[model samples]
Target: MGIDGGIGRLPLAVADAVRTGGGEIRTGAPVRELRRTADGWTVVTDGEVLRADAVVVAAPAPAAARLLAADSPAASAELATVDYASMALITMAFRRDDVASLADGSGFLVPPVDGRTIKAATFSSRKWGWLRDAAPDLFVLRTSIGRFEDEEHLKRDDADLVGMSLADLGAATGLDARPVATRVSRWDGGLPQYPVGHLERVARIRAEVAKLPGLRVCGAVYDGVGIPACIGSARTAADELLTATLAAGAVGGERE
Candidate 1:
């Protein structure tokens, strides 16, 4: 789900859950290297080195491609084949009095024919109950950044993008007030496009990666890019790694 930046506390909730589960999550730690050692896999991030029996890489496709290209050429080639769309989120927040036409349901999705700046808009306050209470004076409007047909629209600067999005939102919701606040975030190579035969490509990648006993890749690029899909891929990768480890141990026991 695309968060409208209204539910500011949701990340805190997620962090608390991780803390409660005794899982330490680190931010700003960039992985520099992943190499196989005699014992297991070594991950070097920043100046810190960590060892694990298995690795599940869930980074974006381009970055993941660079990481795996040297170690597993076939998997890297598959990653390279996957395509992504560049996107930007233009959010404008207005007061309730500013947009009377904004209805109670989710905002509109502009069909390809609309020839408009926004691909979709979610009425932030109306779509989620938690968001409604988060900002009383604020009504959030999220406008999609880029479309397959409209590549030039994404070339605009933040100010231009924000203005275009506001114009579209105003037309759709009949809002006139200048937004109290506007923010734009560009996500380069963000949304993965699931082209025809994408499943076959992903299956081939998985088969190649399976040759590397402890290596796993999981992310929105594979399966589906939805929240559930990412979570499911992560879970499946973990399970597969565990199964492989156990099977290796069983084989070692038999040999012993």
Candidate 2:
């Protein structure tokens, strides 16, 4: 399931929750490395090194590999093996009456064998009731282009991408009207590919990450790339971290 309205407000919502819980949000802190300290972990950023009780490496595969290189070469190597795919989405808004009949359905996914440029299309206003209610006069739809190995078209400029999407859309669904407003968004190296033995690879990565007492890894790289899957994996990692921390604290209390 997708987020209602949209996911643009997600960061702000998370920030609000953090502030409500008395947590400070740090911006412009680009982490450079992860260092295991005696107390916990040291997060080396562009500006400073902050100590933490536990750390979660939720970055993309290449970046996560870079951060974990010194601490766990094995995990770094495994992460390095993860390949990424790029995609561009063309979101266009047309007059509701213009494409009234054409968008009756939720849109369709094009078959690769059909030699189509567009991988899939979503009738945004039709599929999402909230979007329809928000802007009933406008018919919003989006088309996604590019795949794991078929990203040559992605290098084209936004206009070219939009043109390509329109051409494919016309051929597939007979949409000939020009959009009133259009936007093109590119997600470069946004999706990780899972080849054969992916589960085993994830297991190996998790095992290596577990070697660090208070360190855990979670993201689209370790689990499915969908938002729900990423969230679920993160929750699981957090639960494990909390359990381990409480156990260690109990042991320390007994020792004292």
Candidate 3:
């Protein structure tokens, strides 16, 4: 369901796999443009214009829309209409004795109707055995604030956000101890929202993308937003492009 060290490790591991499989993973090069070439796709980045047999654009909807604007305006238009939500995650570390008798569940989700500052709280130390074992003397937990449209709480400063979470935690679990350390991670326009006719919109985007050979797009906007769903979307796009490339004799493999 998740990574032990953290969700961040998943990308690192994927990078390792790419390198192990003789793939070159480039970073720090902001992509300037992506266009379909007669031969394949031309990817112009801050560094250079790289040619590829097939290209997959795995990015947020806005960025993806920009990249596809030149080659597939139809897809770009669809992507531009995709809505998003933002949130901030507050991770706090407390002494083990402080929350030794914390609740048993991994976390609880608060409904928007409740009007709580923190929409959810995850008891990380109790939920993940690896995390607890790694930091035996500390109790770590994460709280999330913000949702689809109601994100007024996220406008506050980090200290203010941390204070709000602490206040809510105290009232709910009687946790009044000060945390030893805290970190705030904000995801602006991160979660893609699926509204009415989302599937039809995605279908149109995919159809337009298919019109341009060697160009494919994937991410939270096209499919489900969970890590597993995103990963699956990437895989599906990669597979589809590879099949197209091989069928057209662009790659070495010959498809039957």
**Model 3: per-residue Cα lDDT at residue 239:** 94
Candidate 2 weakest ten by summed lDDT:
247-256
Better of 1 and 2 by lDDT: 2
After superposition, candidate 3 runs with Cα above 4 Å error = 252-256
Scanning candidate 1 in windows of ten residues, the lowest lDDT window is 247-256
Tens-digit lDDT string for candidate 3 (1-256) = 6678878898899999999998877888878898787777778887687777788899899999999999898899999999899999999999999887777789899887777899999999888888999999999999999999889888899999999999999888888989999999999998999999999999999999988878788888978998888888999999998888778877632111
1-256: candidate 2 lDDT, tens digit per residue: 5567698778688899989998777787878988887768888888776777788888999999999999899999999999999999999999999996694689899989999889999999888888999999999999999999999999899998888889999998898988998999999999999999999999999999999998899999978998788988999998998899898883321100
Best-fitting candidate, scored by lDDT: 2
Candidates 1 and 3, the one with greater lDDT: 3
- Among these predictions, the greatest TM-score belongs to 3
Instruction: In model 2, state the lDDT of residue 161.
Output: 83
Q: Return whichever of 1 and 2 wins on TM-score.
A: 2
Ordering by lDDT: 2, 3, 1
TM-scores for every candidate against the unseen true structure: 0.86, 0.94, 0.95
- lDDT (Cα atoms) of all candidates against the true structure: 0.80, 0.89, 0.88
**For candidate 1, lDDT tens digit of each residue in 108-131?**
789878778788987767776667
- Which structure is stronger by TM-score: 2 or 3? 3
